[model samples]
Structure formats: C-alpha cells, structure tokens
Target: MAQPDVPWPLLRSVEALADAPLAQIADRLRQATLPYMGSSALVIFTEDCTGRPQKKAGEEEIISRVSITELDSLRATIPDEAPWFGHAEIAGRSRAVLALKYAPSHALLVLTDPQPLESTPTPGLEMVRYLWRIAARRIQEKVADAPPSYLLESRAASAERLRVTAELTDLHSTTLETLLAALRSPSLDDAAARSTVTDLAAKALVALRTLSDRTTDLVEEPVATAFERLREDLKPLTRFGGVEVEFIEPPLNGRALPGEVAHAARAIVRGLVLTMMEEPEVSRIRTQWDCDGENLLINIRDNGSGTLSADAPSIVRLDRRVQALTGHLQLEVMPGWGADVFVTLPLDPPTRPAGDVAEWNLAARELEVLQHLVAGRRNRTIAMTLGISENTVKFHVRNLFKKLDVNSRTEVVALAHSHGIR
Candidate 1:
C-alpha cells in the first residue's frame, strides 16, 4: 500500500522526529497515529527482535489507546498477510489493524477504528504504512551518520562542568592572595582580623558570582570575558584605596596567554602600587590598555609621590619581568607629583639566527644599537646618531653580541640581515 501520495509533510514536521534517534524513533511512530488516524486517540506498536510488539505512543482514552501489555497479549491474534491490513474483534468491538514491514529490523502496527468500520476505502491506513517507511529510513540514516542526540548532549554537559571547575580554581587563587595580604596587616586584633576575613569572604563571593554569570552554559569562554569578570571583582579594592580605576577599552576578546604572563603582570602592577603610594595619600589610579597593531600597551598611572628612586627594588624587579618578555617598560616619575608607567609588549619576538644572536637578551638601548648596526653603520656612526659616546656604542655592541651568542661583527650583521632586523 506504499504510495507517492503519502503524508510526507506530517511525518517531517514532527519537531524532534525528522532525524529520529533510534531510541526515540518508536515513540515517533506512536505519535504519528494521532494525525494518521484523524482521531483524538490512536495506538502504535513496533515489533522487537523477539516477535513481541511494544506499544510506543498513544492518547490516554481508555477505549481508544491500548497499552503495550495489551498489545503484547493481542500479538498472537494478529494474522500474517502480504500487506497486512484487516479488521478484528477486540473487547467486543471491531478494530482495524494495519501492519507494514518498515525495515528488515522492524515493523509498524497501527490499531484504530475500535467501534466499527465505515464501508468506504480509508487511504489513511495506506498513508500510515508509507510514513513509517520514511521514518524508519531517517532513523537508520541518523544512526549511521552520528552518535545519538542524547550522547552529544551528555558530552556537552560534561565539558561545561569542567569549565566551571577551572573557574572555581581561579577564584580560589584570588581568594588566597587576598587572605595572605590581609594576614600581613600590622593592626592584628581579633575583631579587626575577623572583619578582614569577612571582607575577603565577601570579595570571594562577588568574584564567584561574577564568574558564574559570565560562564553559564559556556563550554569555552573568551579571555576577555574572564578579565572583565576579574575587573568587576576587584572594584571593592578601588574604593578602599580611594582609587578610581577604569578599563579604557573593552576587555581583550582573544586567546589567553600563558598563565605566567598574567601572573607576572599582576605582580608588577601590585608592586608599583605599593612602592609609589602610602596607605592614605593616594587619590586615584587609572589603568588603560590598548593594542597598536603589533604590540599591546598597558599604562598604569597614579596620583602619588611621583619621585621614584633609581635603585627601587620593586621597580627593578618589574623592569626585569617586562624585559624578559621582550617588552619595554617606561617609568615616568616626577618627584612631588604623580607617576606614569607604560609597558609595550610585541605580539611576537623576532627569530634569532643559529648560534649567533642567540645569547643576546637585548636591552631596549642595545636593541636600538643593533637596529643601527643592522643598517650597516659603524660604532662611531651609531654613537653620533644616538647622541652617545663611541665608547658607549662599543659597550652596547659588546653586550648585544654576548646576548645574541655571536662571535664577530660580521656574524651579527649576517644574522640581522637574515632576520630582516634592519
């Protein structure tokens, strides 16, 4: 009875059935009966491997839909026919049975018209069998092509749980740092310490809440989102220090750098704050960050004693950290005024030639000298251009060669040329 006039649209339009997963396909066939029978109630069954047919879907009407147990009992009463379509007496009423072999693995059975049959030929039975074949093929295709829908859903849920765990780890780290700072306070009283602990707890809660908001249902969050959440969590610290910190541009929405870089940056900024300001005098601190094509620029300025000692250990450590990243740090300290700290980090470091130019951890000044050296300039010419002594130029060149692991000026020149350093 399978024909081209079958109701394909009805079968395809069932929201979750078009790509029917194997486990749910039987239910889909059962649900099909409501539309196929053009009645409020219908029952459907599909035979399992053991010749026992299981009831799949139906309405709750007592007289119309039969349960799987009832269908199983009635299975022995069904006749084997070429295109099984017939009527039978069940519970003292004549009900129509339409059975069709959907695939080698399964067969569909629709039980309807329990009261009496209208004498006319009902194409509905034929249509039901046709739709079953289409649905069976679709279920087979989905099984062959991909994992079941439930399996994918489970995987996605697992990934989300892992992400939340990582976020919790980050929150714990921040909390530990704050607690360590609080414990170092000089005015250690029982009450004051308790208050400090409370404050830390509140801050941790705020951080966790912010992180949860940003990361809900996110399998992989962008670095920018994480940074923005951190900024929000640290807002309370700004009020404590009388500093009005702001992020000039949006948080960076890109891949995350290694955690070491983020940790080092945080340390440097913290040291700058502690070194330049007393507990009560500093009014405001503004941090601005931006990207300029090839480099990332972070500027931290504070309204504090701008005077910085040349031998300040904190600043020295910060400078070393920045330099190690192949970046430059500028400290503009104006005594009796505010200070501005500027950092520039290249997107990628230039490649050094083999053996030569390998050991050279080029200082900013030496980098300038090497640039000139790569331009084919002699030490005297470089000194004249940089407004430095020829002896100073030689000193820088010597350091450059040592850092670059180069033996001679010719090797340096060749390495620079090969790397397009000029």
Candidate 2:
C-alpha cells in the first residue's frame, strides 16, 4: 500500500535553509513562507550581522527603498508585543504588514501585503511565525559561523553605511529645521493647520535622527562587552564539543572596538579553535584577549600534534581577515608540543595615505572640501554633503586655497582637478 505523500515541499525548504549561504537566506526564507502566507515582500532586519542588517526579498522597489525610519517606527509599536498586523509606511508608501520580533535577538521580520494561503488565516499565521523564529535564530547562528571573507566584507560595508547615514541625518536635519522655521512664522496663514503639520514634521525629524544614532551604535561595541558576547557565542561549543576550553578576559577599560573588528576577532579565534579541535590529539584549548590602548591582542593555544598548517585554507582565510584590518597574525608550531597562535588587531583603522592631491599637504577635511569644489558644489552643498555647517565648509575651502596657493574658488577647483584630486 502507498503511504501518505510526504510533504516534499516543506522538507525541501528546510533542507535548503540548512546549508543556505548568508546572501541567500532571505530569499530562501521567503520561498519557505510563501506556501503558508502570501506576501508581496519579506524583510528581515537583524542587528546580529552589523554589516548588512537588512536581509530582504520581494518587490524590488519596496525592498530597495525601505528606510530604517519605517522599520524603527514599526518596531516601536510592538515594544512588549509582536505579530502585529496592520497598514504601515513601508518603502515610502503604506502597505499591509505582518510584523514579528524574535525576543531572543530582537530581530524583526516583516511581511508586506500579507494574506492567508492555507484557506484559514490562523493556521497560516502560526506557520509563518514558526518559520520566522527558525530564520531569526539562523540569522545569528550564521553570523557566529560566518567565514572570514564575509566578516571582512561586512566590516567594510558597515563602516561605509554608517558614515553615509550620519551625513544623511545631518543634511536632512538642516532641511527640516528650515521647514519648521517657515511653518512657525506668524506671517503664514492658517496657524492651526500649520501647527499640526509642523508637529508631525518635528516628530519625523526626531525619528530620523534617532535612526541615525541607532546606526552609529551598531558600528561599534565596547571591548569588554564584545568579549563577553564572544564567550556567549562559544558557550555552546564548549558545552557540547567535549573539549576543555578556557577564556582569559580582557580588561574592562579596554577601548571600544569597531563592530566589524569585534566580530572578526571573535570569528578568527573561533575558527582557530575549531581547526585545532579537528586534530584527534587535541584535548584542550585556551584563548585570551588583551588591549594595549592601540591594539587588541589575541592568543589561542591548543594541545595537539602541532600539525596545523599555516597554508591551510582555513588558516589563510583567518590571516586574511587579520590583514584586512591592518593586523598581524603569527603561528608557532612544535611537532612534539602544540600550536600557539598570536594575533594583533589594531584598535584604530590604518591611517590612509594621502592621495595625489596630498602634495600640497592638505588635511583630510580640506581635501574633502576640495573634492566637492572640483565637482562645482557650493559651500552649502558641500556642507550638506559633509554634514558640516556652511561656515565650516568655508573654513575648509579657505584652508584649501591657501594650501594649494590659489586665490579664487575657480582657481582652487582648477588646481585640484589638474592634480587629479577627484
């Protein structure tokens, strides 16, 4: 007799996610949930991977244009509760949404234009929620086990995004402030109507600034807290991997690490420990971190056959991560003894050498202003671009003129262009 037809689709989805790469998780998750719930879009906002917080799949227009302000606003509505269903602003327009927050990681899952696909709403909702929980947990799990290349890429992207967000907040804040001033003017007619609009604008401005601050917060973590979290990340392995592991903590007063650095550091050490554990002779591993105000020093040693090869792919990847941050890694192996690994990660990013335009000895900010001027941006425009005041832009421009030995803005631009400052 033929048994019941297995739920091949569901099983396949689960199997797919089990080994899905990080870049494809959102798409895979969306496909998995589609059978249970119909939606135009699926978005996962998780701070676990600081580099790329939003993993999205759906209408390209919506996912591409969705703002942190919208997500933060939705997240705010469900402080102690989740599974919120309503119409909310998404991608600059209002869309029906199903929002869920994973309490474990505060990760948010938003399904836009959602509807039941299983004939009844309750059953579909329950299934979607369960799938979300699994996905949310998987998000952090993937981050913990992320490869060196992904970690490095995440750091670069996170840093650039953070810089852009801060600038955007400053630029828009100024615009909104001007709008508020105009709205509050006694010369404007319809005072009451104007006042209501002004209040809403003020709130939006506040939310915008709050979103920028949150982005900055995600870019760095206190060294002590980062290390503590690392311990937590490795706790499972220590408990179940059947190996003796010890952690020597760094000082509480150590400098805060850039989010990427903290993550890379943890991943580097974890990889080392795992590689060492692969050796049958290995029984114990010890890891330690210390900060000397300028660098994060890491040491991991293992009692093994000392067969860990420096040229191994895993070791190479780990070393590449260290070098990406302008850090150094050294390996010491003794055949009869064990393996000792040393890593030094700089607390501060490497100072970038000045470009061809540096011959005039222009400071970084001056060169930035010069670049904008070459592009024919006025003081106000440059100020907006750099998130500085117009007066500060003028100051930088004046300094640029003197440094480049140019009299007028035109001459300054010409000189910059001639020197390939662009």
Candidate 3:
C-alpha cells in the first residue's frame, strides 16, 4: 500500500528533535503540534527496569505530577503500537494523556488543560506517535550508553563563555573602529573628538574591568581556541581509555569560524570520540579540522576494526546534530580496517537577514526591544535607553517571547544570534 504524505510541520519537528537533548524533546513535540492541536502542556518519560517511570533532565513539571501507577494503567490499556487518548486525573488536575509504546520504552505525552479538538484528522495522532517513537529511541540510547556526566555540562559552559566573549569582542572592535573614524572626521571639532573619545574610553574601560576578574578571553582567535578546547576535553578520555587521539591543526591563515560554529564543531568532535569509544578494541584515532573559507571540514579516522557504520545508532544522533546546523556528515567504513567520518559545516551566516523581525510580524518598537534583548540589556536599561516605561519594556519582552516562540531570554538570544542578529 502507498503511504500517505507526512505533514510538513511534523517532519520539521522530527528533524529539530534529531539533535535536541532528550530533556527538550517533549517541548519540541508540543510546539510542533500546537498550531493544529491548540495550546497544551506536554511531557515525555520512560519506565525503568523496576517499572518505575524515570524522568529525563528536561521533563516538564506537569509530567512529574502524574503518578507511576497512572502511567502503568495507561500502558496496560493501550496496545504497544497504538495510542490512547483520554482524560485522567493527575496530581489533582485533569489532563489528557496520550500514551504509546515507543520501542524499548513507554512514553506518556500529557496535555494539561488541552482544548477540545474540532474534528482534527486521525493522522495528527499518528504523526505524534511517530515523533514519540523517534524520541523513545534516543532515550533508549542514553540509557544504554550515556556520555560521562560532566561532558555535556562542561561543553555547555564552554560554549556559553565562548559566545559571550565573542560577542563582546565584536562589540568592542566595532566601537573602537567607529571611535577612530569619528576622531578622523574632518568636520569634528577638537572638543567633540575629545568628548567622544572620553565617553568611549570610559565604556571600554568598564567592560575590560568587568571581564578582568573572569577568565573569559576577549581577543583570542576562535578556530584555534576551538581546537585547543577540543584537546582539553578529550584529555581525560584519552588518558583513561586506551585510545590515542591524534589532533591535526588546521591552517593558521584560514578564516575564523563564528562562535556557534566553533562550539558545534567541538561538540561534533566530542560526539565522534564517544561513538568510537564504543568499540572495545579502538585504541587510536586521528581527528582534523579545516576551514576552506566557506565551510568547516572535519575528518576523523579510527584504527580499530570497522564495526560502526555511517548509519550506526550513535552516528545517526551525530548526523542529526550536524543537520540541525545545515551541515553534512559522511562515514567511510572498511570492514576489516577502520572507520572515517567527515563533517562539513557552512561558515556563512543564515540566509535570513538579521533584524528582519518582519517575519515574526514584530512591531517596530518590539523589534527595537528584541535588539536590545539580544544585546543582554536588562529590562530597566532597555526602558531607559528607549525612553519607555518599565512596564512597556516588559510588555515588549513578553511580545518578543511570544512572537519568537521561545520561553526564556537565553533561547531568544541564541535564536537571534544564530540568525546573525548581533
């Protein structure tokens, strides 16, 4: 039988979750179906060996309130391949729970305060089942062989530091260049030049002083720093494990990568290491990174007997992460020899022009607020600078969050930064 076409939104949701952390999977599913299904809270969880529902790091609060006994009852009521949708009382609140068995584990997607569906197609529920299946597989992999506890935490911290430092460097560099240009302006009076320099100098001094007590590097080249950090991250892995990872430095003259690219590349390499480590006999690996002005090329080769394929479960996860950035992953395996993986990530900014808040139908004032929000300005500071009241700033921020489909300031900043909205 011919299969029906999948919905575009559902497909995009699957792709987004491909590289997303397990904790964020439920929310991603919720957001993807929100347009058709209406606003509702969602949660995903799996059962442990003892039949107790275990929570992933990013599980929502509402899901936490549902008792394990309720989940067990739902599982018993629904067939493994089918979904059950019904109202249930959880934690003194009535919610609609969609229960399904997604392979090795059972997942419950609870919709709290769910609005009644007005003749939505059955295919919508099927799509939800498919999405949950994908998430379930990822959760199982984590259960089988998760990364060391500190790897993700350390990588996240490092990435944030790099992002903030990179942004600050760009800001100060532009400010200094503009200050120089202002000084060289032919129409500028000596008094105006001095005043301009004094004001800029004071701001720069404050910035420098604030960053001095921190270990953040403001002027370092990004690509080199990425490789250096990769080495540090792999140090513990190499030291304890029998593997020896040979690091080949990229050309020093190559163009630097954006902060996000550098961070993602480091993460990609780290993931590759973890994947290859699954082979018990894998003792030696060689990794290289290069930037060809347009794309970041990464090559990794291992000396163990080739057992991992391009489509291996772990590699599939890695591929999703690369694809999230519009990048590509290639794997070469020699059955008796070894495996080689290559990744290509673009260096260009996203095609969408930054500050084009029109896509989100953001008002002019809201766009102004978004820019300041991306710059890490506080609500009070934004209000003062825009000459608006504090309450007005809050109103605009709320609108920004709603328009951007994000919940927190960090997500808004990250999304805007990815779109080249500096």
Best by lDDT: 2
Candidate 1 clashing pairs, residues 3+ apart or interchain = 357-404, 358-404, 359-403, 359-404, 359-405, 360-403, 360-404
Write one digit per residue (lDDT tens) for candidate 3, span 1-422: 99988767656877887766644666676776665555345655453211113332223565435554455455567665665667776545666655556644445555455454557665566556666667677655543333432222223323444466567767876777677666667776787667778677767756654553232332123577668878987899889977888999988788866544565677789899989888757889999999888889999998878988776788887787777567899998887778899999886533545444558888989989988987889999999999999999999888986786554565567566646677
Clashing pairs in 2: none
lDDT tens per residue, model 1, 1-422: 87668645563645456766544565665565445444323343442211112334344353333533344334445444234556644334556654455533344455545222243245555555555666656643442233222222222323333344466757676776677667666666687766778677777766666555433322232345434544654566666755666566535655443222333344455666656555235677777655555555678787777666546777786677676556789888776677888987554333434334444567889989988876768888999999999999989988876665443454456455545454
Q: What TM-score against the true fold does each predicted structure earn?
A: 0.30, 0.66, 0.44
Kindly provide the TM-score of model 3 when superposed on the true structure, using C-alpha atoms. 0.44
Give me the runs in candidate 3 sitting further than 4 Å from their true place: 1-221, 353-394, 402-422
For model 1, the stretches where C-alpha displacement exceeds 4 angstroms are 1-223, 229-236, 251-260, 355-422
Better of 2 and 3 by TM-score: 2
Backbone clashes, candidate 1: 7
The order of the candidates by TM-score, greatest first, is 2, 3, 1
C-alpha RMSD values across all candidates:
34.6, 10.9, 17.1
Q: Per-residue lDDT tens digits of candidate 2, residues 1-422?
A: 98987777877887777767666788999999998899999988877777677778899788878866688778888875358999999999999999999986778899999988877444888878877877777877787667654554465556556656787899999999999999999999998999899999999899888888877777788888888888987898899998888999889888878776887788888899888889768889999999888889999999888888899889998898788777999999989678999999986654343346546787888878877876768899888889999999988877875675443454465344434444
Better of 1 and 2 by lDDT: 2
Q: Against the unseen true structure, what C-alpha lDDT does each candidate score?
A: 0.54, 0.80, 0.65
TM-score of predicted structure 1:
0.30
Instruction: Estimate the lDDT of model 2.
Output: 0.80
